[model samples]
Target: MKSLKFLIILPALFLSNLFAQATILNTIAADPESGIYLTAADYKNNQLHLAGNLSTNNKLRLNDFLGSRTLTISHKGQNHEFSKDSIYGYRDKAGNDYRLYKSYSTPYKILENGKIVIYEIKQPGHKQNGFKPLVCYYFSEGADGEIYLLSLDNLKKSFKDQPAFDSIDANFQTDYDLIKYDNYHHMFRINRVLAKL
Candidate 1:
């Protein structure tokens, strides 16, 4: 009876540990290099797992295009390529998470993850004669795990019914004014607003 009980409990304990590890993997912080590292178990189970003291120093390379991309991870001097559908998400050394967007067929860097996950997109501004191109940053929030681009106009529409609308709007207006005055800290201010929301 003792041996049988131990046998039964062993598998249960193993499964519980696996689930706990999986949860930890899902919430890992971003790495300094912004490279996606994988644990050996991740490859074995074909799931996303946090890299735990993995010796290989190679950075994962993502080849992205307009609507599709491929990920390449190197291990033991061998490169393994995976398609977009095969990957779920990855965390950087800094604790930032990124996941593949099936609709756009690309990966997006997650800025904030909470009740609403926010992702960042950087777009190149058009250049004119004798002027350098500007980089435009946009953020998108996830609704029920669906990503939707967040614009100033959309933000107003989304928060119109919330009690915190007045405060949020005020901060947004102030940030806009600062941007107009070339303060350049508008993005930080916008993030502060989002945090409050």
Candidate 2:
């Protein structure tokens, strides 16, 4: 009886925890005043701009692409599904922008927009000792539009030869330190420092 109760409770707890960690995509808002007409117009006329001077001006509907691992674009009523690997990023009719990082398999929405764009990637962590997945954060600068992996080594390289570099470098020796210092906040803070230089 005790073993039966334990099994039931264990599965319930596991399911609850699993659902708690599920990834939720942010919904981009569209203006209702113009409605579908406006979205269609934008999709038809405006280009789907991507990084590296690439863009697709073909008329396509955004609705055909959402909620799928692959992006399906409609051109002249013909549907085409683009491989995630080939797409670097895309902008929707609502002006919501997304980016695909090389290190990550799927595209992530750009939470913050500026000279640098920030996005998060959730990947499986090292399981040599049986650990769960970990969330990795990344940033891309406007200059190159290349995704730079967020790590202590990359940070040190970025801030190298700058004023007060030694002090800043010493603080982020481990992943724990980076997490404690707030990687998202520090990325912006470091951007400011880079801008000044």
Candidate 3:
């Protein structure tokens, strides 16, 4: 009887957590406004008026690569289209910041925004391996800086000049440690290194 109750409780907890995550995503996706960051300066200043304020009717479909990989916005009465390469990036209805870092077909999601920005992108995985998608993490020095793979070596190279650089080596023994998120602080563990510096 006890075993039966434990099994039921475990599944209940799992479903509860899954549903909570779904709820959060739905709420974020429901935002009615979208903003476009025209340049790195605009992104830094939180100014989104390059192509004028955008409505979230269609929002942004980063995966849309039908013709020239463009982002079309409707403002006032006319329609304005901006190419991925022309603009810095935009915030979707879900309030997620995506960048055309590598000028890829799909924009990379900005996970953490700060002096050192963290980005994540997903790609299709091998077919034989159950088609599990591949997720890659990258980091950039600043909004306009070049992006590098999120590796311990790259982290060290990017911020070697920081006074707290030694702490990175002391605390993070593996690459995973560099990308670990601190739920308590709501930021990446690596950001702590920047917080001190």
Candidate 4:
């Protein structure tokens, strides 16, 4: 697996516009209103898991909306309405809440102290062409409950120049090529990208 060369995640703003609400990341590092919060815990099975929660009990999950379907061409022999596949929201106020759960594929990586490992990229397509992820598990009093795993974009922004680079742990066996045998056309291959800090 290729190691992550850059740190900060880039242009990681896909859902910022959906919010009339405010994020407190500007004020509190662990603010409920801020951005995604990352929390870590060691499981009795000897594995680490990071959990993140949305800021509100009413929230959205982003991963369920990615990818597109092949639309039939118009009778004019031309394709029509080629656009990003979208995840629909409800007509209720809760539908207005920004989704905190987005999907990303990264190599299994352990945190600085070697007590936690965040697993991602379980499929192929979820792994991007360039960039690595810096993930954290967040647990807060909101509907945004989720696991922390920043994209290559955000990883690039936060750790652009910080000297304290976390070392990637090289344990655990990941399928690595699970997508190849998936037998599904739209199957997303999530590659493992690991970063330590």
- Candidate 3: misplaced stretches above 4 Å? 1-32, 50-58, 61-69
- Model 1 clash tally? 9
Tens digits of per-residue lDDT for model 2, 1-197: 99999999999999887766552212212221111112222423433432111123333333323444555554434566665445555564455555644432465655554445556666677867367777777666552366666666765666577663675575456644543423655545444434454
**What overall lDDT, based on C-alpha atoms, would model 2 receive against the true structure?**
0.50
Q: Write the per-residue lDDT of candidate 4 for residues 87-151, one digit (tens) a residue.
A: 21111122111221343211122222112222232233335644444333221212222334433
Cα RMSDs, all models: 16.3, 11.5, 6.1, 24.0
What lDDT would each prediction earn against the true structure?
A: 0.53, 0.50, 0.77, 0.26
- Candidate 3 weakest lDDT stretch, 10 residues: 50-59
> lDDT-based ranking, best first?
3, 1, 2, 4
lDDT of 4: 0.26
TM-score of each: 0.50, 0.43, 0.74, 0.18
**What are the runs in model 1 whose C-alpha is more than 4 Å off?**
1-55, 65-68, 91-97, 103-106, 112-118, 124-134, 140-144, 174-187, 194-197
Q: Could you tell me which 10 consecutive residues in candidate 1 have the lowest summed lDDT? A: 174-183
For residue 36, what is the lDDT in candidate 4? 20
Q: Where does the lowest 10-residue lDDT sum fall in candidate 4?
A: 88-97
Q: Give the top-scoring candidate (TM-score).
A: 3
Residue by residue across 47-115, what tens digits does model 1's lDDT show?
444342234454566666555467776645767787756566665545455666665355566555433
lDDT of 3 by residue, 56-158 (tens): 2544445475645677765555566877788888876556777775555767788988658999988998978788988899989888889889998998887
